[model samples]
Target: MPFAVYVLGLAVFAQGTSEFMLSGLVSGIAEDLQVSIPAAGLLTSAFAVGMVVGAPLMALFSRTWPRRRALLIFLTVFVAAHVVGALTPGYEVLLATRIVGALANAGFWAVALVAAVSMVEPAARARATSVVVGGVTVACVVGVPAGALLGEHLGWRSAFWAVALVSVPALLAIVTSVPDDRPRVTAPTGASVAGTGTPTVRAELRSLTGRRVLLTLLTMALVQGATFGAFSYLEPLATRVTGLGAGWVPALLALFGVGSLVGVTVSGRVADARRSAFVLAGMVSLMVGWIALALGAVSPAAVVALVFVQGMLAFGTGSAMISQVFHLAPGAPTLGGSFAAAAFNIGAAAGPWLGGLTIDAGLGFRSPVWVSAVLMGLALIVAGVIRLVRSPQFTKATVA
Candidate 1:
């Protein structure tokens, strides 16, 4: 993998830190901005909504722009939004900045995925993608906690200040390290041969409309929803069921982050050669992990271990999922990648909202895990169905 992959990863770390820090800042932001906690919570939703909306639009808009130029533009937007967010006087302006930031974030993700894969050999694409995505793991492990700590000591605005300051290096790195020319397009592992320099917007839209592409996108959405729906409530689950101290929460999160690193690294190794099996295995691991959490009243150590295992499973299939998305519509791999980002963000927005409802319904902290498990099981079934129906023999029989 090229050093530019690390640069892209740095960019991902910057935006991802911005994206997740809101979870840790809700209380601080609510207090400082004089908004209801629920209203402050909307900041997270606004970001996710922007990601979903930005993906396809940005993919279409950036079609003619050189990939490096598009990336630099998006990073500039991301960093500038953080500055605006840091200086905002009220919740409304801050919310607006958050949305703008997320739009830039979505664009970066869409372009970055294509750039990463295109920079690598066909067989190494998944591994390259994993390295870029690893930035997200680092953000989760260190960035969110550090932001929370900063907020506690220096106030919520300080956290945004930190994000804005940290983003500078990534922007500079991209300007220096990323190549100016467009990537050479090669056929995806399973994609039918097609002309490419990257598809036109019309071709991109057509590829997105195909049955295989749409189904795979749905699979991506459900799996992501199940993961976040349960994970968003982890703090409460740990406190109520596992009896861990608030101090240990960070440790738990850190352990989960470590497992995420492990999982994605493993995926990097096998995703190219065994993408389908890697994904299936991760799905099964996720189911088992969620089930264990739902079984309830486990020892604190056991709960910690389960969260680590869950994080591993939650992140393990990322490269494989995106790889499949690319293969399903290689004519527009960039747009296909954008769709995956959109689906994941849409799920990130919806999952916790649904999980929150279950908790509010008096089902207790463990309910989200059980609810998420059932939803994940449904996703697993759909994946199987899609696989069966899209198999060569099935397609041939249908044609006959």
Candidate 2:
């Protein structure tokens, strides 16, 4: 409901475009830098690795700072990274810039999530989270595609410049709109602690060690790994396996993004009350969708429709899992978000690597679909165990 939440989402859109637009620009970058295509793709992996390491580290480092100040620092670094990346003459410099940008992006998301949830009432937490995560869905739909188009027409560096330009307005918005952190609380002994109610780093980390919190983080990782694994190879799957022309690749990607938009929006409405059931159903449906896609890869119609379906299910599950992390670890808001961010990025990194391994092993593109299905199946088992453990009957039996 607060305007600052939307501004954070605006910031996410800019950074997320940079995160995904590399998929479209890899070829151009490879050619321009005289690097192999596979070498160019490592840029994406570098960003993912940075996010996995940065979220918690950045959150811990900035935990004592005012939220507004931390956000400004992160976004400013992100914009500057893009500018430097755009002007880089060699692949090594560009790769370093991507890692730097991802670190900033991860920090922004970690803090922004905590800030967004703090601004809203408990009952509206899921809705508030969706508003933040919605930026990624929108970026997938609009920003990445537009970035790709810009790279196609104006060279890849121009796409980088565009992300920097778009982020400037978000930087200005944060300055004007986002509130500074509240004052710290003083204990009876006159020691000051964070206003966030958590007093120490050890306590913050301890809160995340609970069974529910750890499981929720794992579920997030599995769902994301499954989604990205299949998604990373959709192009080859479409052109080679599904027999679609290269021109249809963008359309398929757009369709998947549209489905993600719808999925996250719908999940937000009901996730506050039905987070467990929603995630379970989503993973189940997503597994089935992947299985279907694998079986019917020869049919172009099936591949197209199934990609949309899987996108909806995957993103919907992802958004719900994020809120679930907050709900599970109520004592460590920022750290919980950081843990979720780290989990998702870990999956984002692992998925493509595993998918690539399957391809390099001479498994066809359809093999990635099967890999996604297997990941989702494992995720479903995790979600099911959580659901079972939390059931009223199970608790009563455990007490006995």
Candidate 3:
């Protein structure tokens, strides 16, 4: 991996920390801002929404700019948003800050993925993506826990301040390490590859409509929805269903993160080569994992083990599939990144919302796990269809 990819991962670590750290600070934010806990939780939803909306727009607007410049711009705005979030006096202001920060985060993610892949050989797309996604895995393992601990001791605002502080170095490193974008036709030869040198929005949008690209996005959304749907409620499942004490939640989360780190690392090595098999196997494993959680919720040990496995399967599968999106889309790197980001965030937002709905409908916590399984089943069916439809055109288009 390039040193620049590592630096991009560092930037992702800081941004991702802010994304997941909100769970721990919800109570503090609710109490301090005179809002209900549910309202405080909306802050997370707002970020998700921002990501879904901002990604495509940001990518579209920044398409013509150099990748490094776009990255720096996004990080700067992200840092500013964190600073404002820390200093906000009211819930609404804080909410606005979260949205702003999310927009920046989404933009950074959109551009960074394109940048990282462009820096490597076609064969290394999955490995490069894993390096980037690994940052989020690390954030889950270390940054979030540390942020929550920081909030617990110093106050919730401290976590925001810490995110901003950590982001500064990432911004600086990106400025120094990342190179200017060079002319490279991202599309396959003889195709109507958009953005050969200076890509037009119309051309980019056209490229995104390819069947392979659309299918990839749909699969991404479904898989993420299933993953987050179950993940959002893991704490409740652990405490209420599994009979674990409240203190066990953090450990469970860490275990999940560790599993994610392992999964992404391992999958990165071979996903690109055995792309179809990797996806098929991962989706199947994930479906089984979710069903196991639903059936085994009563056993603390089983639930604990399943959480780690599910985390691994979810992230590892996502890393592999995401690499395919760029190659599959052909010629619209920024737009493809935008769509990927939007698809993932749509799932991120929808998963928890759907999970909450199931809980509110008096379907036990296990219902969400079942929901996860169903989503994975849908994804598996889609992946199967995608595999079945692979023609010579498909092979030709994706042949780097």
Candidate 4:
């Protein structure tokens, strides 16, 4: 509820908008650049790669700076990267700009959660982190759709210009609102200062390596892979399976976004009140079931309903997973959190690629949904095993 949280959220909003708007504008970018759609799609892949490479690198390098100062530096980089992206003359140049932007993004999120936790009391940590991540949820629900409309109506370039324009205010907000508190703990002996050395980050990573965190992250990767695999080809699926025209695709995506927003908001409260792992596991199980039903359903209405449900379960579990990591590694939360973020993006990259292969193999759009279901089922088994391993008796008495 602090003013600083809102400012951090705004920064996150700008970053999320920039990151996700590409999917909606891919065709526009391809046409304008006179390149194939697949080629334009590489822009997205480039960004994901940037995040994977940047998250740990930035965290390691920034390990020594004060949390507030580190965030400001990253936000400045984020804004500058967007400005460059908006003005770039060629596709290669634009791709470079996106990569820089993605790196800035990885650093921004990594520090934001650490900063947020430091700012609030223990009981308020989940809610505060939720507010920061809420920006991404809002981006999916509103920002991406609006940017897509702007790109379609004006031009793809106009969308980046708009992002650049928004970045100005976001930068100013971060500069003025973020506190000047130094991180309470020092970095590890060999680690960088801005990197995760806080008690939370360390504890979470230790827990992550344990049965519970490992299974939780594995479940997350599997569920996200399956969901995004089908979701990446949603337009085709909507067309082929639901018999809908091209015009309805954006609306359906918006509906899914709405589900994600609701799920993310609800998950925080659930994790705060109940067992985080239990909530995560339940959501993952439900998501798998929904995917199967959506794939089999004959009616467009049924498919739409299931899509909404999928969004809810996917992101709801996401919120729980993040909070669980923080709990497990309360000493060094950001490293664990960043690793999880990396896992999510890795899944993001893999899902579309896998889905494309299935489509190319003549398996039809629905086949990806089945693939996702299988992945989710695997995640469920992983989660159940972790639960068994972490049971009270097991915790008190080790099997080894």
Q: Pick the candidate with the highest TM-score.
A: 1
The superposed Cα distance between candidate 1 and the true structure at residue 101, in angstroms, equals 0.3
Count of residue pairs whose backbone atoms collide, per candidate: 0, 0, 0, 22
lDDT of 4 at 84: 76
Q: What is the descending TM-score order?
A: 1, 2, 3, 4
RMSD of each: 2.9, 2.5, 3.5, 3.3
lDDT of 1 by residue, 61-179 (tens): 77567789999999899888988988888999999999999889999999998888878888988888788788888888999899999998999899998988888888888888887
- Candidate 4 structure quality by residue, lDDT tens digits, 1-400: 6888877887888888888899889998888778899889889888989987787677756755776788878888877777777677688888888899899889888788777766787677667767777788788878899899899899888888787777678677767787776544444333234543454345435555777666776766776787687777778878878788888887888788777778777775666667565565655666556566555655788778877877777777766666666776544555665766777777777777887888889988777777777677777777778778879888778854
Whole-model alpha-carbon lDDT for candidate 4: 0.74
Model 1 has an lDDT value of 0.83
Tell me the whole-model lDDT of each prediction, alpha carbons only.
0.83, 0.88, 0.88, 0.74
Residues 173-231 of candidate 2 have per-residue lDDT tens digits of 99999998742433433323535344456666777987778887888898899999999
Candidate 3 residues 28-89, lDDT tens each? 99999999999999998898889999999898778778898899999999999999989889
